[model samples]
Target: MHVVVIGSGIAGATCAESLAVAWRNQPEHRITLLSASPMLKTVANFHQLSRTLETFEIVERWLDDALQYPNLSIVHATVASVDTRAKSVLDTAGRRHAYDKLCVCAGARPNLIATAHPEHVIGIRDTESVKDLQARLGSARRVVVVGNGGIALELVHEVQFCDVVWAVRDEHIGTSFFDAGAATFFMSDVKLESAGMSENESTATLRHGLPEEPEETENGVAIFTPHTLQQRAAKAALASARAGVSDIPSSQAPPEPNQTAPAMEVYSGAALGPRWQDQARLHPIGERIDTPRRVVELSTSVSAVLSPAEFVAYRQQHPAIVHNDTDILDWPAIVVLSNNRVYGCDVVVSATGVVPCADFIGPEILRASDGGIAVNDQMQTNLPDVFAAGDVCTVQWPTSSHWFQLRLWTQARQMGAYAARCIQAAAKHELALLDFCFEAFAHVTRFFGFKVVLLGLYNAQGLAVGDYEVLLRVTRGHEYIKLVLANGCVQGAVLIGETDLEETFENLILNQLDVSAFKDMLLDPDVDVEDYFD
Candidate 1:
């Protein structure tokens, strides 16, 4: 039996490796790995410089060990399409490779914003782009970043040369992974502000001439009038740009240098259009909206009022109106925009998100549904004999009601292993379908500064909501502990600014233990739960 695996990312590599192990003693199965680029390279290379560099070396070692398996083969080619009916893949060179089973692990590509100029935008997806960004930043005194995710935050911290402005459409940064309070704290430290602004509060507002009213039912969050937040964000960006030009203190200043110079500013705004609240929950850190003076609570309804339709349409109707014109486009000598053209800048880096590149899997083999490939629990595509994992396949997380695809590397690796097992099982006599139910859990543990960790599913319902216990402590700083429990069983937890019992907490989550006996210990910080395991 021959199994074909596409892609060379974490998921693909893990799946192939797992299958090779499964067939190690059998020696009857043959594995073929194909990729568009060299194997083991970082996926988009947007990670830390050290991590990106190490990925290449790690992948090379992985491949070397895998090649030792006599039945495995590796091919370097771009897959053109897959014909599920024929059980074959066609490469760019028109060479067709047949397989008994195929796993489509083709990952995603960077999603670029339409407003960005392609020539000025550089995506940090490869080594070349990183080099280009470093070179561009060497001379840049001002830089504008358009996204507000982890990558954007990391970039802002790493690139110290110039004035940095982050243009975000969301009310807050890290909305998905953090709670509102946490988001506010992060923004406070980072010094971010929301874009857009409003006029007199008494006046009736109209976004694209549609009468606007506060949305009260959802979250009761404060709403920024249309254009108000964006305007404020734009102004902040302009201030940073202006500061970049004038704030450089002369070399001959006081012996004790003046420490009151204004710092580089970052402006954030939510994209206009229908707001995706659910998407916000998926972020590893929760989200927040930033104002010039302070972080603010934004009403969910505010998004409905400031929909992207009106914003984009308004810009379309009034071409002369632009945000942060003085800083971004229309500044006199420092910056200039002529007919929507920018003259300055060595390079523009695009830190936009990514989208699955599943087009290579022919339409017949894997039909697109709702912008993602529909897949069964076994990770099999709609067509027979073709399986998919990673960003390409849309698999529902067992815990969350959301049916979106799991794009994280962790999920991809697990799905790949499961898919390989299913394929191998299918090759033999009829076997019982494995239980598709797998808990969707995510957690993070921060060490050194504050030991912070989050586990299990916080977004889902019907599991354990109020039944869980929580402990809040205020000592030197603050410590928060939350646990999820169902029928006295410890499901998951979140611990912040504390690590005395982290190992015990992690084991409880991993083992899915019934903590009924130790229910009283949940509140006691001194209790050593690790002893219970022993």
Candidate 2:
């Protein structure tokens, strides 16, 4: 039996690894992993925080180290197309690899804003793109950021030395993760400063980004933190020393024991998720004079991106138009917002979101309305002996009442592992039960230095209008918790900061317990909600 998997992202890597673990003793079962780039994304330091909540770090492991299993072989080449009829996939090198079973785990690409000036717009996707952005930020004085997703939120917070103009379509920031009230809670500490304002008019600038709500300290308390660069270097040195390689860089860390090293290119892999910015220096060049300014334009989007020449012409035509500085023509890109506001900046970052990479797939395979390859409950596509997982595929089957689709890393990992089990069952002509992960929606992430856990219909997704009630508990700068209740039962929740309510709430959502009698006491600080439920 031959199994072929495409892409080396979290989904592909997890699926391939799960298959190898399940069939390690079966030498006859051959597994071949095809990747466009050499780097393979692996989950490291995974911790099961609760029944449905998990947290992990995404590490870019070399392809050589990833081939830890004897029965697996990796091919490095971009996939040209898939021929479902021939049961084979053609690579860019014109070589066709035949397979008894094939799984397409090719992930999504950033869905960038349609702009006439492509060079002026940058999208954060892979390591290379991030490095490129870091290089560009060296001399930037101002930048325009577009989107309301996690990426946009992170960018607005992390970016220093350059003024940032945040253009969001939603009424409040971080609409993708938090509602207006929750958004207010997070942004409460964020000091908003208008661009091009006089020193007297501008309030004393607080921190350049959102205030950190450290778990160990109260709101106004101060704590010293270790230097991240020195810590990273120490870790790298330790790894090299353990590998018997003295003074070696972390990027050149040795392969695992008993594994043969394979030659591969660097930084050509799929998109890097989560804390990719940590790997690169995002600080702008030169010493900053004043605190960097952040302007939030709510309920607005980037209507157009003008080139330097176009911006100069427009500025000349509309001399009275409000702008940050007099020398606006120096900026490479001038972003025109939907609300008729304009800002000239060094570059425009479109952190909008991503779309599935399904163009290479043939027409025989069914696709969802969102352009993702459609798959049933078994993770199998319309065609036989073929499957799809990760961001490239969408669940077409009816999901759990509390579960819905969100193109997140956690879901990618879950779907990949579950798809492998489904594949194994299909190979033996047996039915496989749906994994419990599909029973509810669960996600763990960090935003503005606060740990965030989302479970079930956290945003009341897919629920009927006026069918659910929401409850919120906010500690100003400490934590924010929101619960969605329907029919007197907990349906979803958003737990931010060190709430310690994930386990109990996960049960509440899963068990659908009626808390009508004690609904008001759910957020009572004095009440032990967990003990009450127990």
Candidate 3:
């Protein structure tokens, strides 16, 4: 049996390694790993520059360890296309390789938005591009970043020297990861807000009158409104009208002076002025605002309602009142543009996220649907002897009718292993389809900062309100712990500034153990949760 795997990304590499292991005892099988760039050189480049450099290095080491198997052969060549009917792959060099089974894990390319300039974009699709971006950033002073994805924000942090201005259409940053309130606070700290005034209708109102003789300020530009400007205008207008009136005789005289129009009330409050307003309007959504005594406790939720009409209404109803203005002109700057162009910069990098690069397989073999390849639960496409995993294929989980897209490294690795197992089972007479379950799991542990792990679907339906439990503890400036429990087992947990027993917590989640007996103890800070696992 000859098996061919296309692409050498994490998914493709995992599939090849799994097949080699499965066929290790079977002498009849031969496995070939094909990639456009061989020698694993690209992996090294990614390790040197990307945010997950260490993670990439670990993965490379794993791949190298897997290559010790005798049945595996690594081929360096670009795959031009695949023929499902003939079960063959054509390389760019015009050489054809036949296979009994094919695993398509070509990974993805950079998904550049139409508004972005492709020339100025830097992405993680390849190692060469990352290296080039590193070189460019060495001298860049101002960078305009576009997008609200994790990579976009990560780039903002990674490029320390270059001022980053992240452009986003959304009202807040990290919408996918944080709830609106948390996101609001997070964005506030990072100075992530909407850029340039959202249309005129979206601009806030000014309740007060404009001041005469603009006050000159040192910083940027400031617009000031005098405290009594509105009152003075109203009085002058009333006096002028009264004098001009050849009063239509005593009888018609405007119902006496008692019926005079009510005086206009001018509001006096500090406001975000015109220049600052313009800055707010034009600035990107994910740029950080560094201030003295950064406060992290303030939390505000992003409103569930997000529509252009709603935005317009909010602005019309709540115009910003200008009380005072200050200059931010001296502050470090990052310029963001819709198009790809470099003005003055120390670094120019692209935050283009990954996209499906299934060009290796002909359209006849795997048709594209909704910007992705359609696949069944077995990760099998319509084409025979062909399968795909990771970002390329979609799967329907038993929990929901909606098909989920797997893009994470862990998911891709699992899918690749499953595909290899399915293929191996098919080759043998005794093959049983394995029942696989897909659950959405997202976990975050910010080193010494905070740890948050979510399992299953927190926001999904079908969950009984009382079926879940939440445990929270704040140990006075030292530690904060939170846990979400379901059916007496650990569903999720959030830990801040402490992880003494994280492994034990993780084990409880994975094993789905009954914690009913220790429910009280688990809530106690003095109690050791690890002993319960024993």
CA lDDT of every candidate:
0.47, 0.74, 0.46
- The CA lDDT at 262 in model 1 is 14
Q: Per-residue lDDT of 415-469 in model 1, one digit per residue for the tens? A: 6667777787778834425433244354342322345455553322334334443
Tens-digit lDDT track of model 2 for 405-441: 7888888888889989998999999868998888998
Off by over 4 Å in 3: 39-68, 169-171, 180-352, 364-370, 397-406, 429-454, 458-490, 494-524
Q: Which stretches of candidate 1 lie over 4 Å from their true place?
A: 41-67, 125-132, 185-349, 365-370, 396-405, 430-437, 445-452, 459-492, 496-534
Best by TM-score: 2
Instruction: Pick out the ten consecutive residues of candidate 2 with the lowest summed lDDT.
Output: 250-259
Q: Which has the higher lDDT value, candidate number 1 or candidate number 2?
A: 2
lDDT of 3 by residue, 180-278 (tens): 223322332343223222323111101011222434321222212222323433433342233221111111001122111112211111111111111
TM-score of each candidate structure, all chains considered together: 0.62, 0.85, 0.60
Clashes of 2: 0
Residue 46 shift from truth in candidate 1, angstroms? 21
